[model samples]
Target chain A: MELTRHYLIRRFREYYHKAKIYEPIEFRMREWAFVPLKNFPDFVMVRHVSFSEMEELREFLISNVPAHVYFSSAYYLKPSAEMDEKGWTGADLIFDIDYDHLPTKSLESAKREVFKLLRILEKDFGIDEKEIEVCFSGNRGYHVHVYDERFRELGNMERREIVDYLTLRGFKLKGTQFDRVCKIIHRYVRDGKVNVDEKTGEILRSSLNEIRKGRLDLIPPEVREELIERCLKKLVVHVDPPVTADVKRLIRLPNSLHGKTGFRVVLIDLNDLESFNPYVDAVAFGDESVKVRLLKKVRVNFGGERYILERGRHSLPEYLAVFLMCRGVALYGH
Target chain B: MRRPFLPILPYLERYPFLKIGSKLFKFSKDEVLSNVEKARDFVEKVLEDKVEFDFKPIDFLCSNCGIREECEGYEGCSYNISSAEYHLKLSRAKKAVLNWLRCKVVVSNLDEFLRRRFAVKLARLYRDLILKECDDFILFMADDFGLNHEGFSIHVADYLKYAVRMKSDDWKLVNRFLSKGYVDLSRNEFVRLMEKVIKEILMEKVQINLNVRLKVDFKRKELERLPLKVECFPECMKSILSDLNEGKNVPHTGRFAIASFLINIGYDVENVVDVFRNAPDFDEDKTRYQVEHIAGLRGKGERYVAPSCETMKSWGLCVWSCEVDHPIKFYRRCLSGGDKGKRSSKRKGDSQDYA
Candidate 1:
């Protein structure tokens, strides 16, 4: 099943609560390294999700597990521990997604669908593709992993934004969940004033066929361009404010503490929400404004004086926490 | 016998000749003798007494005698007594005169005659000695006198001309002297000189036999006549012929040449033996075989076919160069009498021609 924002949030809460109460989530600073796990059964087996309910279970496994998770066809899969042991870092990861799979195939159909989802996370939710790595699992699935530094301090709401972003993109579970994901993405576009022309509508009707037949290029360039532009415009205006607000809001949670200073203070303003959604042509400006307002409010309340509003979903929280810690707010205690 | 005038008596005895000549001429004997003695002594001393005893025998003449007037032309003459030694000296004087006469008579026309007869010989001997004992001398002269080989040769020739200018009829006696001191020539040099003389004599218009004894102690055939033409066939062929004549192994050159000659005569190689025997120099079967082999005409049998024009072409010779009209002619004309089926059937057909 397509993971709902509620389900993703629940999983994140579980992990966050567990980390807060039971275990001191060991913070290890590491540089990036990628070791490709292609042709390995371990990588293949990790992506196998059979039932619709498994979506929740998969999200939980990905978010909570401290182990390195790799998409099947990902060119690299080095863990932090691997980097630590080797004492070397700095490698690029090249993921080969299996577009033959249904979920991935859906994502490829109507460039707007995937673009739309990416726009929600990136522009609306302030998530970057860099922070969230994605690949098509070699079998019949797509794998999205949030490897952003913000994930260490991720609360329920920030995790929800990631799921909502993926779901909006075209990720779906088995059978009925695919229809739900499609409906949700369709509704999101409709509400956001995303324009779908007659040709694009026709293409959408035949999208599954095109994807199944492995002819994703069948969509004309003009149509793909229009959809991507429109979706990007929508996301650019809609997602940033909310993502910023949500990041600020999540920082107020007891678990989201500054490591140095014991104080909990937010420094960003919701009035600056319009500044975050700088794209004037975006179709989902209202949604972006709302997100920005929420993020600004959270920043003002929880982000301390030293916090600087950096670009991207993953870094905003880390930067805020670091800023608060620099201002003498101890993250562990507060 | 008074002790008186003892010194005066000795002086008087010492001056006896002077006293006698002075008294005979009249006047105070002592004064006259002194004046006459001074004049005579001055005359004798100036005339010939100045001749050193070490003067050569050729310069000898009786200087104290009244023969001084006749010795006008005999100054430094070998007959001069002052130049000669005593009793043993007289013998030496006689020997010196004889030697001088011999040198005069022997060496007068000696150089001219010997040069006319053995100029080249002497020149060659001189050159050989210059080359042998005088290698350092030759090198020094070549460097110091700026002489190249030609210049050195010219210098040697000039020396020879000078040496041979001496008049000597008896070469043996002249050679004896030359052996002692003059030439310094070695035996090899003498032989070379002889060879040069022989060569020169050969070049002369006069008929002469070169039957000289060689220094190498080997018997040499007398060269009785000039303009001998030496035949030089290929060494291999000559060896073959020599071997055949001497009943020794015949060489391949003779065999190959004879075989090739037979083939060139338009005879099939099968008839090589017959053709070889017909060759002008052929005398026996062995000689014939050798000739045939040398001619490259040896065959397996009488009926054996010669190689075709094409076969010859394949062997890197032009087909047109072969005598046969066609390749098959060798088999049909040459080997017809042999076993009919002995050759391959393929060779009997046009296929062999194509191949």
Candidate 2:
């Protein structure tokens, strides 16, 4: 009999019971094919049970394998409400530990940091070197396998207590704690003792500083407020000087109320068209032809957009005003 | 023994004919003037001042005369005697003046016209022959003047050979016309043909020589010193570099073979060279060897030997060596029976697609 069957049951209970001792309700074991573990036993058998009876199963597995082992829940847990309804699956036991996610840029330095973390686990947490196995999960993470068999018959509550004890003793869940641990490992790897080049050294140092300052998370509230002020100043630079006051007032108003009631109005002079038309040889008939040609050229270069053309009267001042308005709209509108 | 009065004799002879013709036709002064004007106009326009007049009417008549010993055509005839006697009677200064005057007007005009239309020296020779009035010399001058000129006739054979080599229809036509002399060639006609042939040959020679020189320069200056960064053993790079330096002659011959091969496969020379230039770590010797070998293979009706991975690895230094997405992948395909024929066929297809 291989150790993983008993070891797996103990690990399952440790997370569930949140205690080191309990009574068993039921226990059943099934023979499985021999799947070679990288750093553990050659074969693995599995035990199945209800959540209530998980403690005794843990006790039973624990006694069989006294070697140090790693454990996790068989299902992923998320903070969202929609995820809570779905019961956990056994696949969650395979937590991915990505060494590359270390805040450093140099791959070699990052890998060394991962080794340092593993060394801590081996020496401080009493994890067995022989029982540990590393796997590339084909993405960003690595799967560290521990096949030590112990507390195989422990009840769920008892197993949970052991996990609680370990948690308190500094073993972390997958969040900020995990992120910190990864950073520490990466730091040791990036120490100047390695044969890394100067460029890699600079990148590693910069990345470490970023992690330390927690800049990886969202920008702080104060920073966000400053950014908004900067954006307003940029907008002010682009606005016309004549409309600067109105634009500033518009910018100060909230978006919802401003959209409901327009805040800024632009008035353009339209008297130039009277003299301009004669210079351009644009009579009423020729006006249409010139307009068509101009529109075609515009379409060729700038494409067309839908706009409401407000034609007041056929007077020169009205035409000039309309032309100015069209120019403004073409310059600024979508 | 008396002065021959040659000017008055010609006038007298012409007067009798003029009088008889006027009587027979009963032409008025207006009609006569019109007739003279019309004749002069026709002569000026049609002949372009190139016609010759017969001054020795007695000699002309005697040459056509049937009597033996008295006719110019007869051996030791009286025509020669009359010509000698006529020549002896003229003052030396008068004869010199007449010859000088003829040379200035007739000979100079013919020479200028021939020079403009034909070649330089031949026109000068034609002028000389006209001035000398040596009929025997004129025929020889004509033979040696244009396309049939003594030294230039060899170009006809050379052009024929070149046409056969190039397999061009225009060149073939030129070759055929020149070799057989089938076209009716006057001095001017021959000169035009010769000029055309010379121009074409000069142009083609210039183009080919430029192409060859550029290809050689590219191989020597640019392609040979490619920056090849091999992640493999340093020995491989060393050996490759050695092989390239040792087989340096390959690019020279290879340029010709490769250009010919590309042209045969319907690629322009520039495109082929450009493709070769941009190919990564392209082994000039190997590429040249392969192209030449493949062309030979094609000639022999044998299958083209696809390049190996090593060959392609060398080729992959330049970006445009092959069409595969990756250099390694291209090498793999080349190793795994990638069709040389298909690649060439694809190039033809691509050219058509672009067109």
Cα lDDT tens digits, model 2, A1-334, are: 1232232234323333442332211111111111112223233422222232445435433333311122222222321113223232222111123434344433233334335434533543344555444432222223333333321222222222222222221122132233343354345434653234677556545676663443333323453345333322321111111111110011110010011011111110122311222212211111221111121212111112233333332222222222322232211111
TM-scores, in order shown?
0.14, 0.15
Q: Which residue runs of candidate 1 sit more than 4 Å off their true CA positions?
A: A1-107, A110-113, A128-148, A155-158, A165-334, B1-355
lDDT of 1 by residue, A1-334 (tens): 1222232234333443444221111112222111112211122223221122424434444344312222111111232233114222221211122234223253233223334444433543334565554322212222233333323333323333233333332222222223333344444343543356666655555555443333325545575456444433343212222222122111111122121222221111223322322122111112211111112223333312333443223223333333332332212111
Residue B133 in model 1: lDDT? 28
- Candidate 2 ranges with C-alpha deviation above 4 Å: A1-334, B1-140, B145-188, B193-349, B353-355
In candidate 1, how many Å is residue B18 off? Answer: 99
lDDT, residue A233, model 2: 30
* CAPRI docking class of candidate 2: incorrect
Q: Please give, for residues B259-286, the per-residue lDDT of candidate 1 as tens digits.
A: 4433433444356565344344566667
Poorest lDDT segment (10 consecutive residues) of candidate 1 chain A? A281-290
lDDT of 1 at A68: 24
Q: Whole-model Cα lDDT per candidate?
A: 0.30, 0.29
Tens digits of per-residue lDDT for model 2 on B264-330? 4334334444445544456666555555444443322222322222333434322122344333333
